[model samples]
Target chain A: AQSVAQPEDQVNVAEGNPLTVKCTYSVSGNPYLFWYVQYPNRGLQFLLKYITGDNLVKGSYGFEAEFNKSQTSFHLKKPSALVSDSALYFCAVRAFSITGGGNKLTFGTGTQLKVEL
Target chain B: GAGVSQSPSNKVTEKGKDVELRCDPISGHTALYWYRQSLGQGLEFLIYFQGNSAPDKSGLPSDRFSAERTGGSVSTLTIQRTQQEDSAVYLCASSSSAGTYYEQYFGPGTRLTVT
Candidate 1:
């Protein structure tokens, strides 16, 4: 079974500083990793995904994630944090296989990121 | 372009009562999904529907939980004899297709409170 693990329950970062939200995964085959952000009372917004190629994937709002196969990790990063960036972050993973049988994503417990000014 | 929409942004019901949650996917989307978010459960996949085929209902938790998509555009999730444990945010999402390459767009979610 494919699963995602987000070790941090919450992360605190000062405004304008770089921020990192950790995520790791366990899967049998190649992993399709994704990062999503959700603000209060809003739906989750897709940040980026690692399908193929490029170990470092860049996404919206100056966010990016590094996909490390050896470490089995896909950690979300931002060069500079903004107060508005405070939200709940989720990491998800799915395995690549025939029949696309695993369309259902296994999501992590989620991390609450607080970017303080 | 309007994104996926869910009706009754918030619903409060008593235990043992029944409730229905609706989702309107993107105009041309062929795949729809329902998920539940509880305090500790994270996101639990409830069901998945692809095109006109039989839905993948493997994720549903109990027989009391059922869902259907009509005209391949809108979907409804009904829970019979709701329990307090069923109180959570129910989210609806839709993708252009069930392929791995397609991204799923989520709705704001309906916050269900069973008291």
Candidate 2:
């Protein structure tokens, strides 16, 4: 079984300030982590993913996330927040049981980010 | 190319009625997925399709829920005997390949309301 937890329901940040949205996971094997963002009346957009190699992964819209194996966490981050970044963020995980991406993906409850100008 | 698309962006049906939601994945994407988002359940994987075949349907909530993909292009999710608990946004996503690192592009979801 695989699951992800986004402890924070909402995170408010001022423009130009750094922001972080924390996520943690539990999986039967090595995990594949992903971050997706959703805007009003829109589908989730892929942000970034942590497959292997570097612990820090950069994604779309200047967003980045760090994969901490020891902490069992993958937290999304941005050096400077923008009002446009306000949206619902979800963290997902997939157990590396297969080489195919068709494996089921377990998602967190989601975190709402409100970036103020 | 266009991204994934869904028809009937919003649907309202009386309890016990059946409803069908359609999804058109991105062109040439071989892997398609269905997920449900609701206030109570949050987000959950419903099923996955690789081309026209569905290797696993265990994620589906119950017998009332079923899906089919044809021609490796479009897919439809059917819900029978809808209940208020069935109200949620149904999302569809597709990926170019089944590779572990492949990203699943999503489509704007269908908002289902059971009255």
Instruction: Please give the DockQ score of every candidate, comma-separated.
Output: 0.74, 0.71
lDDT of 2 by residue, A63-114 (tens): 9999999999999999999999999999998877654543777899999999
Q: Model 1, which residues run further than 4 Å from truth? A: none
**lDDT of candidate 2 over B1-115, digit per residue (tens):** 7999998899999999999999999999998899999984668889988864545788899999999998888999999999999999999999997666678899999999999
Clashing pairs in 1: none
Candidate 2, chain B, TM-score (2 decimals): 0.95
- List, residue by residue over A21-89, the lDDT tens digit for candidate 1: 999999988898889899999988888999999999999999999999999999999989999999999
Task: List the lowest-lDDT window of 10 residues for candidate 2 chain B.
Answer: B49-58
lDDT of 1 by residue, B22-102 (tens): 999989999999999998778988999999989999899999999999999899999999999999999999989888756
What is candidate 1's TM-score against the reference? 0.98
Residue A95, model 1: lDDT of: 86
What fraction of the correct interface contacts does each predicted structure contain?
0.54, 0.72
Backbone clashes in model 1: 0
